[model samples]
Target: METGDLVRELRTARGWSQGRLAAEVNAACGTALTREYVSGWERGKVRPGPFYLRALAGVFDVPQAALDAGRAPGRAGGAAAATTAALAPSVTSDLLGLGFAARLRGGPSADDWEARLDAYGTDYMSSPAADLQRRVAEDLVVVQQQLDAPAMWSAAARLMTVYATTFPRQESARSIQWFRTAAEAADRSGDVGVRVWVRGRGALALGYGGTATGLADLLADQALALTDRPSVGLLHATLGKAYAAALRGDRPAALHLADRARRIFDAAYDPSARLSDYSIPAWRMNGFLSLLSARLGDEKQSAKAREAALCELPERLPRFVTHLELHKGLTLVRAGDREGGLACARAALDALPQERWCGTLQMLMAEIAA
Candidate 1:
């Protein structure tokens, strides 16, 4: 096989277009290459330089030697191969065969769709909302046509969760519309777990604005009612209710709810689980507690939660870590260190990428400055 043939095979095996391949290469190598370049290279009209060859090797998870040899890389044997083999199916379909027809099919396979959703969920806290929203919207167009399939219901629901969160909080109507769609999808899926997940996430989205406490409360109640199990869903619902209580100026109730959320988190959290939006990490729970405590003017509790959140914080989630710092600033403001608190808040905002800042962060900053 020629290098071009090998490149085309690998790209098509992953169901990527020339444009997608170009995007992946650019992302990996920080290059400005385009689909036209990808087309030229695959047609043997142009050859990649050493730099691009190395970039392509990394993107394709193959050795530079394999590309140079103009052959497919040898697969490993046994269980690991069994697991990954389906992800890289043989690209033997020629234009006429049923295999070729299926290869040209529009919708993603169940596993592919699920993996995409999982990636979206895992990247939610780290990626810019606009970027994440664009990616989710692209997938939504394809998934929307297949919602009648029970297998696609969970995908639809999860995609709606992304839409619900990515919309600005001030756009409550748009956000709630997605939340409602997610609820409908979850119900149609008939998966109790997904139903709980949607309601819990919806409650949090509604609670963030401080004006939709009633809707947040209702969603949280439904989330809890759907499951007696100790789960991430339960933790989120409890946190949502805690936020609603805090917004309503019921400090004791908020504190109690936060404590309950912590217990559910302790019982349910799986250290081995994939780190996605569907799973509540200790850091996220602590951050919420810190924010809620700060809002209630409980400086000590807020400080403890802030420190706990910081200690377990992951490097990828800068926005969340920044929010935790803002919570500390809020505590400082409540303690009369007005100038220091404002400085702290400003520093936190400065450390985060401006594109990732959202309405919730702005609200926190406003509270600290006020």
Candidate 2:
């Protein structure tokens, strides 16, 4: 096929109308590329230049030269993009919910992450959005081969604690490998921030299935004291601590840290959104706080926390954040009201953040029934 023919063929194959293609390309670029422009390119009336090439590469996920050569596109769903999908565990669907939420809050550019790497290296432990922590973790898995990239590795270390809470019993050896690689990469760079990040990862791993001794408190301390000063990541660590304490039935300690985390939001940084705008502020602790209060039978506090979390939460959460709603729903169900709890669970099920969690939540429902 000629250029126009190729474009038409690929676009049709993906079932993308000009508008869909334009929207995808627009998302890839930092700016919107209109439908008319998309129309022009597909018709081959005007060849796409380098800018178009980069944007198209992101959209089609193919090498620019290949796309130009009229080769098949490399998208996860499209013909050419199948390689990475096949090689990886197909985590894109899970990560995309995270990415889309992040994209809503912040534009994705390699340069932005590169700059974050540099800034974080100096003081890596502090001040991170939830999305950054998550992306850095997933990126380590995708680019573990690029061990030379210190910035990437540094970011990855910090992200470990975030995902650990989300993935509890589901943690895998691959997850540990990613964490170890990131930690080692940070150590090689001699980035203290990375060290703090690494410690957080270790603490998180321990909490997941290993040691629990002082895990919560020690993690918060390491995250805070590792660098020149306390970092927002310390709060993230605290969040993990709170979760761990809850698992331990240490209601007082968990609630204390969860409350502390909520308080920290008052002084939180205003980073641009990534994956989801909600990840930037790193989610409303009030949600957890409310749920915790419910678990503890603090009716007044539970209502308060719920109101705050619901208010602070953006109307439309990125898919990644939505996954936690299931856990929250479960907490509600186990509290006292089966019908209301099931309703909450149904809402989360309907939202369908990530597919992997589908089975987990389904099982959780069965357990709740039993």
Candidate 3:
């Protein structure tokens, strides 16, 4: 077995294309290797140098000597096959790469791409999920086409994070796919914060979507373990677990988890800082509280949390405002005003654009009706 053969096998075993392999290598070693370079190495047109060999070893999680020996990392050739079977769910099957054609010319500068991603983040806060989904997908095609450098992965990760959030209610399967890709892209960006943030957000999405509370708990626990210091990741993950507990009818556990999340928010979150796509802002934290408390039948706490959330929520984010309103209606129902409460909840839902209704909102609406 040649080194090139081993490299190709490792890449294919992980279901990665030449471009994804290049991204992984670059991310691992801070190198500027491109897909063409990956092609050359895999085809035996050129061998990877010593430095690249080390980088490739890390990317493949194999011993460097395995490449030198031109053999699979473990158990002759069986380990690679075993790894493929074991990690297939995390590994993407998109061999051609995100449905984007590679660009012939250099695309936007790194700073320019960062700015564009930030703008997309802003749009995400204000736009309807269905409307924003199409635009973000289009932008991602452009970003994927120009993903030749490490910095581009950060942009791709951020864009995919926002894109995944748009898919929760309407498209669960697609949501899972994009969330997995977003986490992969975040890992490739070599940013620990981004990696934690993606997982934390995905956990919350799973919980709020009422789809997989067990998976949500797993993702939240993983996010909590990722960092030693307090962070928005920890806060969001705690909140996600709290919501999952509430959904499971574990009232005491849910309240305890919510308390833990509040402490993290108080210690780690800056009250004066602006809202961010990556971090949990004060309003968002309160919004989580509002929904959690409402679901738990804590009318007083739910009303307080709803008031706090509405006070800080930006005018542009009408969806969040509507969420808080739904919480108010839930509180009203929990307080014995069923007729008024149901009407309020239904009216709030009706007032919001049909395209903006998400899984979280729908879940709340169903609870109010019940």
Candidate 4:
């Protein structure tokens, strides 16, 4: 609904240089309308005069009324992507980043595996704001044809991951309600590992919003025992349990588990093991551990973890990875380097350009700013 932001976005999407757009407007004005005029409008720092409105329509490639349309509420244009991204985790592959490939394969190494699993917690629990009704509907139609439990459970895990995000946003009520349905489907598949994985995500979604918080740990614990070592399910269960602990306000216990998870992740560096085959997802582990370390007041450890995460992020695109920048920024602040921290956080924010899904990192920045 913000006309300025919308204009900026449209311009960027079209790959139009601001100078070029300005030239078009100036040509129509029969006089020089400096680029500053356009810049001011895009920055939301100023409104254009009535004379410029007519020219604005031509440059934006839409009718005059369309440019003025929906300007009242602000941010309505940005909402589509934001809402869509917030509604589902699996669908927000840009946010889920690198974890998606591995989840698809369902494997990870003991080293860094737990951290990778833990890191995805934020994306999994928070909704990307999509209406997944159509996809879920399609899935259900196909799911009926899936006689194999493993196939059904695999689909169930993917759907559950998306539903977990949708549940918080209330974007897909049907999908949220059907979480139990998927869980049952997974449970019936008779593979305890799949069952544990799905249940862990369910518990994670519940724990994320602080509802059914107590039971999440119980389910996560169950997932823990069910999964074997060096498994994706096992790693996910560990992170899920740690998050439940964190949510319960037992940071010490959370740290203990987090530490073990980190060690498991570190073991992937074995000289004999190929980093690719070991299946340990470095980005998720770093993202999860770094944020948690920052929260526990372990600045030195947090800084080290976050620094490494930034290095590893180039390979993936999880929305939560942006928070690694936020964490390092905040840790710098706690370390009394306010300027560096601000730069890091601002840069991170700039990279993503929004905080609709980064609740934890947003709060951390807010605290620093306060």
Local error of candidate 2 at residue 263 (angstroms): 4.1
**CA lDDT scores, all candidates in order:** 0.75, 0.52, 0.74, 0.54
Report lDDT (Cα) of residue 255, candidate 1: 80
Q: Which regions of candidate 4 are displaced past 4 Å? A: 1-137, 144-150, 166-181, 202-212, 266-280, 315-320, 329-347, 350-370
How does residue 291 of candidate 2 score in lDDT?
A: 45
TM-score of 2: 0.49
Kindly give the stretch of ten consecutive residues in candidate 4 with the minimal lDDT sum. Answer: 167-176
Residue 16, candidate 2: alpha-carbon lDDT: 88
Per-residue lDDT tens digits for candidate 2, residues 1-370, read 4555666666777788989887665432324678888778777778887657655654554444566777764433663354344434556666554545554554434466556555444222222333444555555444333434565455445444334333322322223333434455556656775576565545434432322324334554666666533444555566656656765678888778766766665565555644321232534555546545544556677666666556655554433234345445555666677777677767766666343342224434443344
* Candidate 4 residue lDDT tens string, 277-307: 1234675567667766665567988877777
**Candidate 3, 192-224: lDDT as tens digits:** 777787778877876765555665787688788
How would you order the candidates by TM-score, starting with the best? 1, 3, 4, 2
Least accurate stretch of 10 residues (summed lDDT) in model 2?
168-177
| TM-scores for every predicted model | 0.68, 0.49, 0.67, 0.50
Q: Candidates ranked by lDDT, best first?
A: 1, 3, 4, 2
- Prediction-by-prediction clash tally: 0, 15, 0, 24
2 against 3, candidate with superior TM-score = 3
The reply for model 1, stretches above 4 Å from the true place, is 1-106, 169-172, 208-211, 336-339
What is the Cα-based lDDT of residue 52 in candidate 3? 76
